[model samples]
Target chain A: MTGPLQQVLGKAAEFGGTALAKLQHTHVPGVGQASTTEPREVAAARWRAVTVFRDDLAGPFPELEALGPDLEVRMQPAPGDRGTELSARFHGTPTDEQVGELRAALRRTKQLAEVGEVLRVDPQPHGTRKATLQGAALEGAAARAPKEGVL
Target chain B: MKAAIWAGVNEVAVEEVDEPQLLNDHDVILKISKTVTCGSDLHLIGGYIPAMRAGDVLGHEFTGTVVERGKAVTKVQVGDRVVVPSFIACGHCWYCSQELYSLCDNGNPNPGITEGLWGQSPGGCFGYSHAMGGFAGSHAEYMRVPYADVGCFVVPDAVSDTRALFASDSVTTGWTGAHLGGTKPGDVVAVWGAGAVGQMAARAAILLGAEQVVVIDRLPERLAQVRQHIGAEAVDYSTTDVVAELRERTGGRGPDVCIEAVGMEAHSTGIQGAFDQVKQQLRLQTDRPSAVREAIRACRKGGSVFVLGVFAGPVDKFPLGAAMNKGLTVRGAQQHGQRYVPEILAHMESGALTTEHLATHTMPLSQAAEGYRIFKEKEDGCVRTVFEPGG
Candidate 1:
């Protein structure tokens, strides 16, 4: 019985020591450091098309009460050499399908850039989205685009 | 032993009382050498604070010589000259460890809640109301101080009691305001009220390198002192539209920081005007906003407002929308006297902060009641009245 009890106490001490070490490692000194690769780089690689939508439809799309009845919606897409940029404004919400259609239109307009995926989507409260499209063959396609209204 | 007692609102008397004895290992018996009445004492005398009884002691700010110490007391020895912080604190509690000594968990006389001040209720206070800890005040010949090691400060032999007295409350309170407001070099700071605390706030602002300091008050004498002694511009709220005047002086932007030194007793005629304006436009009633309203409105966008005043009950109809829209931050706490007294004493030693101008009246302990009366009536240009108990 004494041998078994001694083993249990030894295990408890080891567990406590390990837990304290992990806590000290994670919480002390270097807790706030960030990795080197910028968030924009990852965003550019994931999105092939840009989509602009109203603020209310930025979350899950296509619900009856999402957009109020009185809102007026407008979509404006500007053509760019590398990819097309889309901007939208509305008094209320918009459907997800409407946002998807805008992305398709942008992809077709920028045929020189092979649209790989939707790399970024930013929803502004005043109804705007700035998205970056990625291409498999083209390196630094995002950096080459002109900076203008993309959302 | 003789003690200063309050007979009724605005009435005070001195009478013989029982001498204090140490009840715990942490207690010490102090023979008070000096004591002074605080403005908060008026709250009790005027019945604004409930639970005050006849023959209760009336002083909170004091300094004394310790005649005896409990067995557990280690920091201070007998015959030590100590300046006692107004609030008692236990050094071991989380609040005390963080230097928020006023909120010490183990310090308050009432164990379960925040009420103990010195003598009155579990929120005991020395010589104030029963709602505060009911500990007898230092106005007496002898008094008991609990947790003596934690709350008492040894006065440097070079410092006079008159100059070091304010380290108990007002000076530290002013420093707390400036510290919390984040006053920095080139910031424009405005302090509302010209009381001793307000004057100290202006001084702290100057010390912190505020480019301009504006002090607002209606008293001509106080305003003059603010200008001559505190070296801050004075605004007489009685004659001047304070908000408009401040904005005009600050190049169309309000003060970068505003300190509300007046607290809950702030009275203003602008409440009716604000209410009328809101009623005509938004159909809102704002007739009851305090002077803090003006301070909030006069603060620049993204500025800070430090409230150093004592207030009771819920604040009514504050401008939440304006604070949010302008990104203004409001912060307030009771003065942590224990934490700031040492620094204030150093400033005093260096001749950097002069409190002599604030001591407009001084008298012996025999005339203590009259001192209270003079200060209460604001007679003889009294800003602060100090009583030399041993004199």
Candidate 2:
């Protein structure tokens, strides 16, 4: 293997790893196919998975069919993780308008299947819980830092 | 909506903050009827827990009426009177599946911060410092309860709100401490700190078949409560030699189990207390482990040691030597109230527990700042202050 060819192979492997890590590679071929008018690079970027939800519940698959056929949600088991794995695919590339809707829908469906629903927060639930200024000193100084069963 | 806001260190006020909204499908909107101040909240308002943002709503132990529910909430319905546990559990995480509610893996939305703080993140808690999952506390007219189907338990009409409120945290935590302490028939238990949690721990030990229970505290009022209501021998540790007295009462052997119900910020009557004061003042240690250190020192060799009190960071002189030499089995946790909620309700219904008397002060939610002042100063022998959000 020459240096140039070997470098190209290495780059390809790195790109594959990144794609798998992102879970962006389309499992369903022709599902997110580009139209004749669309640019290939733009279409690929839009088709990449922006969010993924995985869980294992001992019941029927979430009837997210209301999510529509073009917008597909798949559930399957991944090794070493509990419950099912769920991911969504948008037919063609997802527009900015479609992405937020898909993320919200996927989050809702996953919460429903896994824990029954998105655990809501009051006055806004999701935020940083850290205190304002206490950690600064210990951090500057290089500061360091449950049972089962019913009775 | 009005709620008790932690405006700054040593400053608590009832202010108008936006009432909680339903941010998830499993969420429920509760019109809080009864919310109580917890001892742990002191750590928050004292600025010891760190990362407490101004305007953080504060109150975790509460009972309420569910006024609204998200589409997915099925276990509880709108208009149901319920008591929500302090620590939020997703009910399906690895920790929740194991019935360890406080350690629920998926419950804390801000895992990155907690992971940075504690090496690994635990579950979120209401109105507790943001270091835990920073869910808003319940000292408000309306509370947003996440995973209502899992965390909210219905209160039976037979059990009054006053009696059932402790089921959310104090009662369950004491129960957990006793249960984890391996309290059983013929076992002698020693509990440090006669606060609400301490009294409950003493009672739980007795209920679990402990032959004798001894509670140590400096407050006479709390000691009396422990002696009379909890039916335990109370030690005025400030004057008496607690370690010596326990050994004498236990036939020259220390207590079979020791429960440290007083979390951080324990008052001590000895030189160690002074040391802790200096250390805490110098920012050398995050917790004053007077009760916990005493619990370890006083437990019988080979006895189980359980810390029901929560401590955030490093402590000086934890008595690791005593633990290793004596072969002590130590267990501690934030209360997994979810696991014990049903049992506690049954206990309340059966008259095995009485918490109504603990609610010594009931005030309108608007007086929250005053309520915290009385609680912090132990004014009028106040053991607990119950705030009525709808009062």
Residue B18 alpha-carbon offset, candidate 1, angstroms: 1.3
Cα lDDT tens digits, model 1, B315-376, are 55687788889899988777777788888888888888888778898887778789888887
Per-candidate TM-scores read: 0.66, 0.77
User: Model 1: what TM-score?
Assistant: 0.66
Q: Which portions of model 1 miss their true places by more than 4 Å?
A: A1-151, B111-125, B270-289
The iRMS of the candidates, in order, is: 33.2, 14.0
lDDT of 2 by residue, A1-151 (tens): 3677555554544453333222222233222112243354364344212112244344343434554667755556755655555566577766543543554454455556556555444355322223333323222111111100000
Best by DockQ: 2
Report how far off residue B226 is in candidate 1 (Å).
Answer: 1.2
lDDT of 1 at B326: 89
Worst 10 residues of 2 chain B by lDDT: B110-119
lDDT of 2 by residue, B1-391 (tens): 7878887779887777776787888889999889999899999999888656666788899999999998878889888999988888888765677788888755765443454444456788888865565678889888898888899999988999999899998999999899878899999999998889999989889888999999999999999898789999999988999999999999988999999988889899768989999999998888888888888888999998998887887788889999999999999988889998898899899998888878989999999989989999999999999999878
